[model samples]
Target: MSRIDYSVWDHIEVSDDEDATHPNVNTASLFRWRHQARVERTEAFRKKGAELEEALAESKHELTRAHEKAGELAAGSSKARDDIERLKREEREWEEKVAAHRREEKKTPWNADTLCRGGFSKIAVINDVKTESVGEETETFMSFEKRYEKDVKRFAAMRSWDDSEEYLSDNPHLLCAETFNLLMMMCVDLEVLKKRESLEQTAHQAVVMRFISRLAKALKVDPRACFRRFFSKMKAADQRQLDTFADELECFKEEVRSAAKSPAWKAMDEAQRELEKEEERLEVFESLPEEMQRCFDRKDVRMLQEVIGRMEPAEARAHMKRCVKAGFWVPGAKVDGGDDDGGSDKEEDDA
Candidate 1:
């Protein structure tokens, strides 16, 4: 009636019950499904290929960066190696220079003998001069007694009588035997005079006169002449004290003589010889070369010796001008032109 769409069902197949014993399946339909499956597989393969391509590009970039970093590290390593080599060379050079300096130092000898030519004690001559100034007044006898007491106490404290025996055995002057003997004799005479009342005045005068005579003799003067001169200076009250002082003076003179002959004298002589030798050696060494001579111009004696040992004599002589300028040595050891005889030869040739 209204043109129902029965024509739309034209391709639709209806199978009768009697004829549907086996259902028909088309090969084309199977081929169409297989084609779709194949298309899906191809699309998946394309996606995987695209992903692999992107990953490969990123890997290539990373590899390029790694190579750049490796090159930079290699360059730094090379620079470090170069610096190490340079430092090693500098170290080697420094060591060589130090060794050379040490070798130079070894050639020279240290001479300390120069300092000892004279005894270390300074000797000065003191002239007696009159002074208006007066010191605090003290009795001469009291002062002498105090000094003698102090000397005795010091000697006792030192136990010099016992401990100094070894030194005395080696050197008789160290014991001051002559002074001790003089002191003992004077003491015995005084004791005897004190006990004899009847002969006291005569014995006192005789003892005093004899003591004064002995002192003058020890001093290398005439006893009678010296006593007359000495008595002229004294007031009557001081005469007795002066006589006593004369006795002490005699003993003191002997002590001084004995001390002078001690073993200290021998040691001093040895020291003087050593000093002379040192001065001689240094003077000879200084005469060597001009440059070496210049080194001696300085006050550093040890360094001059070292430099001298290393230098040639001719070279050192050439540098003598510097030594002359510095005043370490006198100049003109080397002459200009030739020897003194050469002048005469030159004059004969000119004539």
Candidate 2:
């Protein structure tokens, strides 16, 4: 019986010997470890991909915002350029308007000579009047009226005329053939009252009358005025005379100025002589007593001294006594001492 069970024991012992030689191992465990490592690698790759996608989306959003901001800046720049262009255009237009106005102003008729002398051909019609008898006269009258109206309009425009209606209603004649020339002249001379640098009143009056006389003759109109225009032209003839006189006066003044520099003009010579004499007289007067001051100032002292020195002793004594009586010389002064002997002799004779 023991031999029969020994075969089973030999088989078991053979299996154990084979297991010891191979070493015990499990296929399922090896497979499971390799699968776990592969899963971890896949999960890490997926997470990295998600993070890259998020970063790409954020970059795209920032790019879009930058584009919109750039568009707004371009629009703002365009608007600023348009506004500047408009302002420039407006400035140019204003400058053009200013230039045009200045040109228009320059074209206006302001030549004093042309206005006064009726040089302009432009005319306006007055009411129908006697053409045959007073054609020339009427033209002149109308011209004057137009000139006066122009002046009144100018004054009104300047806001200088207070009584416009009254001035217009009065219809003051600037020149009337019927009135005395002197009256018109007087009106012209009134201009001098308003000015500090006018001709002398008497001289100006004379000049004005002379001018009016000629104007009346030339125009064959009465020299009359409802209102005076200050800067009217003088008659050509009278103006010529005045010009000649003024030229002569200017020449004379020039000569005087030249001669004054040279120390030779007669007036200056006379003035210098007078000044010297006055100085000499003042010196003498200053030395005299207050009571005798007037007499010394009045007399030529050098001449008086010579006269007294040349006089006979008796006459000189008499003169000294008179001077003493007049309070010009004090009785006990040196001037009175010269005649003392004569006075004593006279007193002795009287005794």
Using lDDT, give the best candidate's number. 1
What TM-score does candidate 1 get on C-alpha atoms?
0.17
The alpha-carbon RMSD values of the candidates against the true structure, listed in the order shown, are 54.3, 48.0
Residue 53 miss distance in model 2 (angstroms): 99
TM-score of each: 0.17, 0.16
lDDT of 1: 0.43
* Candidate that would win on TM-score: 1
lDDT of each: 0.43, 0.42
Candidate 1: deviation at residue 73, Å?
A: 99
Q: Write the per-residue lDDT of candidate 2 for residues 204-223, one digit (tens) a residue.
A: 33333334444444334444
In model 1, which runs have C-alpha deviations exceeding 4 angstroms? 1-237, 269-351
Q: Which ten residues in a row have the lowest lDDT in candidate 1?
A: 107-116
Q: Which pairs in model 1 have colliding backbones?
A: 289-316, 289-317, 290-315, 290-316, 290-317, 290-318, 290-319, 290-320
- Candidate 1, 127: how far from true, in Å? 37
How far off is residue 120 in model 2, in Å?
58
